[model samples]
Target: MLDARREDLGRMLRAWRMARDPGLLPGPVPFRGHRSYLTQLDMALLLGVSERWYRALERGEDRTYAREMIAGVVRILDLSPRQATALYRGTGHQPPRHRAGGARPDAALLDLLHQQRRVSWICDQAWDVVAANTVAARHCPWLMHPETNTMTWAFSAEARYQLREWDTKWAVPLLGQLRLAWQRWPDNERLDEVVRTVRREPGVAELWEDTTGVRGDADDAARPMYFPLVAPDPLDVRVATYGRFGDTALRWVVLSPVDPSVVFP
Candidate 1:
């Protein structure tokens, strides 16, 4: 029983309002407030409408408003074109166009991956494997190791054994991270294709459907690894992940030695 218009408006308000910094917005600045101009009274004055009427519109009690009025409010709020359009659409007014973030992978990002000696890999908003060093490629070979990076391999076949841990503990956190990426890049075509391919794996599909968040319960037990090490295994490793923000994002995960004494897998 959520009102779509109210929800959309709330989302937009939250999104826009959170971006404002007190240092950036003018005024004597209340000690804690972020300085948003969209107070209920201000909204009423801007709309040239009664405070009660405006309150009703904000509370989802009113379903319609004048196009010009909505546009004026949109301008007063200083919304981006897309944000304004979303507001207009939510209010049953004609929206100009739909636009979403269009960020891409960067080749320069490989430098960041290469600098680290630990097991490392990079994935975009869709969890597309953009880059991976030799260490990550060696151990977690099932999904990311192949010529074509596929998420399906994580849940199927030998991965249950390959992960160095029992049960879905290893796979679940990875899937959760990928799920976060999917939420951000819902329209990525490659991601859609990857999701379709992963669905064929029953285990992956089940985990994907389960909404519970993944926690690293097995983190302590399952050490960072590279399967079948050479004779002089030099280090004890632990898995740690890092993220880099792009115009969109790319999750750059690096698995490193918790202590030097621990040997390679």
Candidate 2:
């Protein structure tokens, strides 16, 4: 039974690797002379493990594998939540809870965001912007940037200028949300990077350490917030968030105009 499971895992990993688009993966595009699929060496390097060890695992020779290594594989391969859970169980490690999150968003969620009449965006548990609708892109152009992350944006000098109530309302509550996510996904490297980046900002480190159990009330109260647009107009928008269906760790954030008469630019 153990051998069978290992073989199954090996096959599945190979299939996933083959199916992945090279352009979407990190590192150089022509990875090790293979444009379509990743070699064992490439996978090993990405996962920070030895090529021989990775090959051994693929051959079902390494029965004892670390959970962190498995997690790294999941991240590097961009595996779905379901696939990650299955890999964990097949390798004799207890799978993490369904909502263990990451940067990737589901296709259905992206489609929904695009179809929404109101401005909507999707983010991962780490608060990385995954997708945004046309209205959101038009109003908040920064959201369309390739490197935008919620925590990074909040602590930025640009945010200090654009966001109303940067210190009290924006930064404080955002830090609280980060804290809550940190508690839930302690080992998430992306979240770790966000925390590190936020701490470097002036006065943010103190707030992060001193503030305990701060959670965002946007979803609970459906409160409206003000966002300053580049066009010298401030929009009052109510925020609503939804979790992705199933065990995925993706969330959808929708912004509706508080005043019906106000039209988005």
Candidate 3:
């Protein structure tokens, strides 16, 4: 099975190499009168590795791989973000994080939040509330704060009281997301701080460590919630998260009532 994976990656790499634009190749083009597609020798020279080593990777031989080796391949080939991610994952390594949460959402994107009458907010890759509609603000007061991180707030002591089935239903899935995010953006200080803060809280560390609990998102079931407005009654909501094609930093988190008859302020 492992051998099959390696062969598949080798073939994929060859295909991407074939598809590369000839004009993008760095250094002088190889001497056999270049038409299209860089030779393995060209790739080896540019990657600063021996021709034999590069061949092993391309031929799916059992050879040790280095992070920088793959990084060099990415640069030399000018791989797209998606392509780069595929390469890293293929090599059984975590891809370096991109600047997904760095840019502020443009006016048009922010307008989306303002236009929504539902309990909706926009969060960055770090899960910081970039913008929130009035309806969302009423339910999550922390969103009004300029620097509020939704992830941090959600993992806080107070969240236990508001989020129903806080452990299995909510925390488990969310922790999975947190783990993946941090793995991608290992250098993100804010995300690092959030992990630390949550780990320090009693029992949270245990939850974070439960590998079985890691999930991609926290919306598989209705998130039973409680708030002053819904006092004595649970405000069940279905969560949905959205992201644009090229915008990695922008995520739209919306909550719709489980019962269509329910409406938000």
Per lDDT, the best of the predicted structures is: 3
Model 3 deviation from native, Cα RMSD in Å: 17.4
Candidate 2 root-mean-square deviation in Å: 10.6
The reply for model 3, stretches above 4 Å from the true place, is: 1-101
Q: On residues 20-67, what C-alpha lDDT tens digit does candidate 2 reach at each position?
A: 764454222224454776788877776667998888777766468888
Question: What's every prediction's RMSD, in angstroms?
Answer: 18.2, 10.6, 17.4
Candidates in descending lDDT order: 3, 2, 1
Tell me how many clashing residue pairs each candidate has. Answer: 2, 0, 1
Candidate scoring better on TM-score of 1 and 3: 3
TM-score per candidate, chains pooled: 0.46, 0.57, 0.59
* Residue-level lDDT for 93 in candidate 1: 84
Question: Model 1, range 49-99, lDDT digits (tens) per residue?
Answer: 777776665655545677766755553444667777777777788874332
Clashing pairs in 2: none
lDDT of each: 0.54, 0.69, 0.72
lDDT of 3 by residue, 193-254 (tens): 77787778767888876755466665647888875664468778788888888777778888
